[model samples]
Target: MKTLGQKIRERREELDLSLREFAKKLNCSPPFISDVEHGRRFPSEPMLEEMARLLKLDVAEIKRHDQRAPLDEIKRMTEQDPGYAFAFRTLVDKKLTPEQLLELVNRSKPSPKGGKK
Candidate 1:
């Protein structure tokens, strides 16, 4: 579970690019890049895309390290259906593991005409 900064730094180093050189190529300041590598900041979506290209890494790999919660989506879901909020609370109360939760979701999905898909 490497942080985005850690992944970026490692990939950049593997490419033999200095911090300053990488920053120059990204059209950002070296200190800004340093802050990102130190986990004090995150790059914008466009910058992340360029970074992925420069490092020859997948955009999904960079996004996977984004730790920000989808707060807006969560709020919208809870507001649209209070049942969602209750379900979320129940999940927290039951302390269900991720695997168990995924299993529950899979079981709840509609089956095919004669059997499960």
Candidate 2:
């Protein structure tokens, strides 16, 4: 879960641009860029848009952090899989181990053919 500031900094570093150099391109002060990178300030919408263009990053990627839903529902669904349910009851329920669950998932992977995996 990267913050917007971290995303901006990553993009800047990926381009190998110094803060001053990047600021020169953005027509802003290096202090302002530093502030944004340090999370002391947030860029305006227009500023974000411009930065996205300059940095070659997706605006949404820069703006949002990655998040995941809780795994409770997924766990319940996995419990219902007949192929895995026995293993889950016999091993996972008894020992609360995840080895069998991982093996079951690994077995389900499709073999790679011509296409990339």
- Model 2, 7-104: lDDT tens digits are 88888999998999999999999999999887788788899889999999888877664233337865887777775557546764566434655676
Off by over 4 Å in 1: 96-117
Which 10 consecutive positions of candidate 1 have the poorest summed lDDT? 108-117
lDDT of 1 by residue, 30-86 (tens): 999999988998899999999999999999988887776788999999999999899
RMSD of each: 3.7, 9.9
Top candidate by lDDT:
1
TM-score of each: 0.76, 0.54
